[model samples]
Target chain A: MIEIVNLHKSFGKNQVLRGATLKVEKGESMVVIGGSGSGKSVLIKHIIGFLKPDEGSVMIDSVDIANLSENERYETRKRFGMLFQMAALFDSMKVWENVAFALIRHGKLKDKEAKEIAVEKLRAVGLVGVEDLMPSELSGGMKKRVGLARAIAHSPEILLYDEPTTGLDPIMADAINDLIIEMKKRLSVTSVAITHDMHSAYKIADRIAMLYEGRIVQTGTPDEIRNTDNAIVRQFITGSAVGPIKIEGVTA
Target chain B: MIRLIELIGRFVEILWSTLMSFARELGKILLLLCATMKQLILPPFELKNTFKQIIEVGIKSLPVVVITAVFTGMVLALQSYTGFKRFNAEVLVGTVVALSITRELGPVLTGLIVAGRAGAAMAAELGTMRVTEQIDALETLATNPVKYLIVPRFIAGVIMLPSLTIVADFVGIIGGYFVGVTVLGANSSVYWKRTWDYLEITDIYNGLIKACFFGASIAIISCYKGFYTEGGAEGVGKATTGAVVLSSMTILISDYFLSAWLFK
Candidate 1:
């Protein structure tokens, strides 16, 4: 459903992505694993039509989204939903309003119907009776759940999750992983999730791609990744400090 | 001698770079203004959000504007009375006060005050939204952040600044009346007559027009700073400060040119 080719991005003197490329099939869960600041977020941002690549194209269903006009890109984005690393809920809005935002604005649904759908989506994410509460009133895990609810509220054809399991306890993270699995099964949507959490990546990804130094170093199933011979992939999956991957801001 | 020449070259280079950066920032702000104008004519006018911002930028600013206008008028009256007493033209205090308040103080003071208050608030709010990724989330949901966020503020600022200036003008005239006739012991009927005699409708409308420009500047500058904010909490602080500073400078600087054109 999505294909990125030879993508290159730079922020001033910092070259974050250089010749990175990847592809994902429809209705498949593609998890991108990378260390912090590995341009994982940048890659997905390209797919979602947020950032334009300097060198290459991001093709979604054969259309180069990088070249679309602002209005056209906005139309293309209707098929997408994203959960930010911080949940990024509208602090000014109620939980239900955040979830029902697209429904009211884009879907053109009335308040009553939008609220009903919001409530149903919240329930699907295992959240009940917290619709009227503000985002500031929720815990970290609850905020993530609420974000998930908001993401899936419009039943988007594709979903993107940025560090969905980070900052949560192991149990809470596991629960989020399970929710990701469940949502993929229920909605049958294409998803691209970026995370450093190997456990969550293994649990939720149908195929895992390891992003290293602005390129996809390896792509394989969980079992294959666990048993890979590539030193970088093996070192990353094993969580070893001593590895070929140089830790940023650290002297070897 | 060689060192002095090198120092001069370095200073010129620094000055040129500063000017270039200022020009770039101005270009960005103008682009934002154009984008906002484009969105303004587009469909999906957010009336609810606009009304909310009107209250935020207009009605809520009433007390401070009124207070400033009243004090400014009173000060103008007292100062004019003292100055005119030398030539025994004390009776003209009302005329001076009325003209100054209607044509200059009313809109300028209100603009400065709103730029400090509403402009800063708008920047802080939008900056926080940008850093927190709520803005990105909005884009992902197929919602135009500029339309949903900035257009309402632009409408509110444009609508409310003039409205607030009107209130300021009225209150300021009343203040001058009290100080000139009651406190300073000028003839009540003559003071009232002189206040209206020299104050033309053109003066008030010109001031209102200036207020419109100030309002647009405040909204556009604040939104631009906020919408592009980076670096998190510290970035928010900087954006808020930059909004107020830039808005205030724009108002004051533009006031001179606007006065030159409008009055001439």
Candidate 2:
């Protein structure tokens, strides 16, 4: 349901996306994998209108976001929910308020009704007796769960995950991965995720797209990604620094 | 020389771009306000949030404000008396003190002080949120960052500033009275009566109006800077400093325009 064509963006001297193009069919889980600072976040933001492409178009369900008015973009944004890399919960608000944030934003339900829905959603995410707790009070896994619950609270048609499992321990990360899979099956929502974490990408993505130098070099299934012969893809999946992906002083 | 020239050009460009962005963001706010004007009078007023913000920004700030205003009033009286006594028109000390404090100093100083306190804090809080991507997360949840987050502060600024300005004006006049009547051995009744005698309705009104505008300007610019903050922790620091400087400058500059308009 998303199409990006000839996307190019530059921040002063550094050009990130140069003629990058890609498409995802409806209800498809497309995982975009790239190294840190490889412009993956920039690309996802373009699709969501957080950052505008310097010279290209992001078409969501046939509506070119660049052409839409601010109000229209906002309306379109309602269909999407983004889970930020850091879980990005409003610290001042409690866990349920964070989850029911969309309900409040949609401006339909009253506080009492919204709180009920928020409690139910929190329960679905395996969080119990936690509505009163602030985001700072929760553990990393709990925060991620709350974030996931918030992302799905509005019943959004599109779910966007930005590094869904970066900071979690292995067990918690697997739990999150299972939740992603469970969410996909239960919601039937179109999912697009961007990540540098391989274990996360492989665990949750239905189809994997490798981003290199700001373009998708290869797009394939999980099995295909595991057995891919492409050098950049191999270097990336294997987590090697001494391959086609060269490093300076930093190690992954 | 080449680098200097380029720097000049870049500074001009940045200025132009900032002005444009400010215009666009203001346009967005105006449109939303017009659309929500009906909602303003509707139910679900969210008065709870409004009261919370007023307490947080206005009530909690009372101690510092009281100290600043009272001490400032004392200082202004002491300084103005020195100048007026040289001309042997020291009896007009009450008039001079009352006029300056009520008409100009009250609002301006209050604006500066609050801008330094609440304005910087607002910027820092919002800036940290922006850097941490919490603001975007707010948007994705369909929260109007302006309404849910900003309107409370805006309303609080408009309400609290006038009260604060009144306090400043009152404190300043008392300070002048202390210096004139007690310190300078003038009659207490005469000094107090003279202070009020010269104070016009417009003088107090002028300062109060200025306070409202100052409050709005500081709230808007500080909130905008923090809302649009990028980078990270350092960026938040920059936004905080920018908020204080920009709000202070806007208050001073706008003071000129407002006084000119009200007096012209």
Candidate 3:
């Protein structure tokens, strides 16, 4: 289980996350929905040890990961698989190498053995025979699939996805959402996905958490989130410009 | 009077902040260097990547170092001849050329050349990785990027700069020989004799030592700039330019001090 409590992070004066708290139970898919710059990425980054919180704790499997030493954090990170927003495949490596990265690096698998597994994972993601190609050669959907293959390649205990379907078309996004669901079911991995896509959240989430401004405003099942009477939740879910949520400086 | 006081207060604040920012960045770079050194001493050192960077920083830099050395030597020889002729010390022209090339110009020129070529490239490549989130990906894979990306480059810089400086020194001496013997109609044997007699092993060693430090500084500063880059494409461009400029300035400034310390 991953538990975050009262996380506070600020970059200069922007104050990206303040008192943000959420939790993901073991073997559950928790989709975090937030607008752009809503600190979803910051929250996940804190969990992954990329950023340290100013005033809270990130407990991963009962240990506060925020305070772990660098070596300890690295050791803890071995069980994590993250798919970045842009797929973030190493352009220096071929597609297979990208997928097989964690396996070869941390899993201590031989290159040939890792390659075979990479090929299998690619096939599982519906990408076939593209192992020799570079990431630049792949399309947006293909890159995301490769990213997904890379994420699940090591059978990590926790998988973090950052805006996985942001750039894809509706069909591709739905396909990705289905893949996330399938991967969760197949791997039994605890998943935390940050996305603004409500449809994706509805499809993939066992529970939905909405981050408004800095803090998590609501956490409930997708049905509850959709049917909530809270104006903030309703305004975001309905995709309306007119609401209690102001754009700050813009007059609408 | 009140307006002037406020203006002075604002200027002081800006100046203080700017200096503080510089100090902060310097501290970060020093920390990065220490981490790179620690990772470098650990087992599983990357031999292949180090050799690749050596080729990139040393072998690929050969032509530029050669051209710079040759011109510098040729100019030094000509200038030395003009100065010594009036004093009837023409025989000492080769000695001056050899000493200046071995003790100063060789390492400094080679450093600047590599800084422009390899340092800028390192910064740009790493900056691109930063913007593309590949560096963050390395972390997620449980790989310390300092070990994987930086240590190899630092090793290459430390190992290859001296080697490149040796090439630059030899070629520069040969360039001086060419100008002195062939171009200026100076006696070939006398010129060679003076060069060999006056140039000591210590001079060459000092220059090579400077080259090693120059190489490490270029690598560390370039990697540091690249690693911390933000703002996407424009940031990468700025980092690349900054790497080249800063590395070049460092080489020149530190060359003076290293010369003083080594030769004092």
Candidate 4:
């Protein structure tokens, strides 16, 4: 279980997160949906201990990660697997090397053993016969799948996905959405995904949370979120340009 | 009077911000250095990466360092001939070339060349990694980036600079010998004898010491710039440029202080 309480984060004058609270049960898929720069990424970064909150407690399995030492934080992070928005594969490494990076480094697996697992994971993610290729050679959708393969290579207890379906075609996006669902079902992993893709949210989320104006405006089952009467939620779900939720610095 | 005061205040504000920025960067660099040092002493030293960096910084840079050092020595001999001929001290040309190359030009020129080559490469590579989130990915993998990415490079820099300087010094002396004896009609035996007589172990050691410092500074500055890069492609370009400029400047400036301290 992951619990965040009253998270407050600011960058200079821009308050990205303001007293935001959220929780995810064990073995549940919770998707946080919001527009760009809506603090979804920030929330994930805080939970992962990449960025500390100004005032909050990120409780992972009831242990407050905010107060952990550097070494402790690293140990805690070993339980997590994150797929970045850009599919942040290490360009210097081969695809197999990128997938096996965490396993070799943290898990202390031999190079040969790690590569075997990397190939297996790649196959699991529906990619094959591209282990020796560089990330530069992979297509956008392939890179995302490779990223997913790398994330699951370590078999982390928790999975975090940032903008999973952002830069893919509708077909590729649907494939990824399917993969996320399949992975959750197969691995029984507790997952937190942040994406603006409503289609993806509805497909993968057991519970969906809407982050607006630095706080979680609503969190409910996908069906409830679909039927919610909140004006902000409706405006966002419909992707309307004109609504009570103002696009800052732009006039409606 | 009011306008003048306002102008002065604006100038002070600019000056203050500049100073603060410099101070902040200095602090960050110092902190990074401390962390790197701590990692150096800790267990699990990365030998493979250290060897790779050594080959990159020391071996691959050999051609450029040789070209620069050889040309500098040849030019020094030719110019010294012109100056020494008037004073009837043409025999001392060999000693002059040997001393200058060993004590100053070899280390300084090598520093600048490596700063341009290896330093810029380090910055650009690390900068790309930063923007691409590879550094963050390393952290997620439970790897200390300072340890995994930086310590090996730092080790290579400190160890290889002096070794390269040795090559530069010897090659530079040979360059001077070719010019002094072949082009300038100086006595080959006299030139060789004079070079041997005037060049001391201290001069060579001091120069090597300077090269080590230059190497460390170049690695640190380049790594630091790349580590903190924001924005994107433009930011990486800026970091690469900043790394070369800062490393070269640091080598030149530190060379002066090092010379004074070592030879005073």
Scored on chain A only, each candidate's TM-score is 0.99, 0.96, 0.98, 0.98
lDDT tens digits, residues A1-252, model 4? 999999999999999999999999999999999988889999999989988889988899999998999889989988989888889899988999999998887778999999999999999999999999999999999999999999888889999999999999999999999999999988999999999999999999999999998999999999999999999999999899878888877886
DockQ of each: 0.94, 0.60, 0.90, 0.82
lDDT by residue for model 2 over B21-67, one digit each (tens)?
88997786466445434444544565777798788668877777777
Tens digits of lDDT, candidate 3, A17-87: 98988889999999998777788999999989999888998999999997788889999988999999999
Look at candidate 4 and tell me the lDDT of residue A137. 100
- Could you give the CAPRI-style class of model 4? high
Candidate 1: tens digits of C-alpha lDDT, residues B64-100: 9999999999999999999999999998998998899
lDDT of 1: 0.94
Please give the CA lDDT of all the candidate structures: 0.94, 0.84, 0.93, 0.93
* Quality class of the docking in candidate 2, CAPRI style: medium
TM-score of 1: 0.99
A71: Cα error in model 1, Å: 1.9
Which stretches in model 4 have alpha-carbon errors above 4 Å? Answer: none
Model 3, stretches more than 4 Å misplaced?
none
Residue pairs whose backbone atoms clash in candidate 3? none
Top lDDT hit: 1
lDDT of 3 by residue, B1-264 (tens): 999999999999999999999999889999999999999998777787788888988899999999999999999999999999999999999999999999999999999999999999999999999999999999998889999899989988999899999999999999999999999999999999999998889999999999999999999999999999999999999999999999999999998999999998
Docking class of 1: high
Task: Pull out the clashing pairs in model 4.
Answer: none
| Descending-DockQ candidate ranking | 1, 3, 4, 2
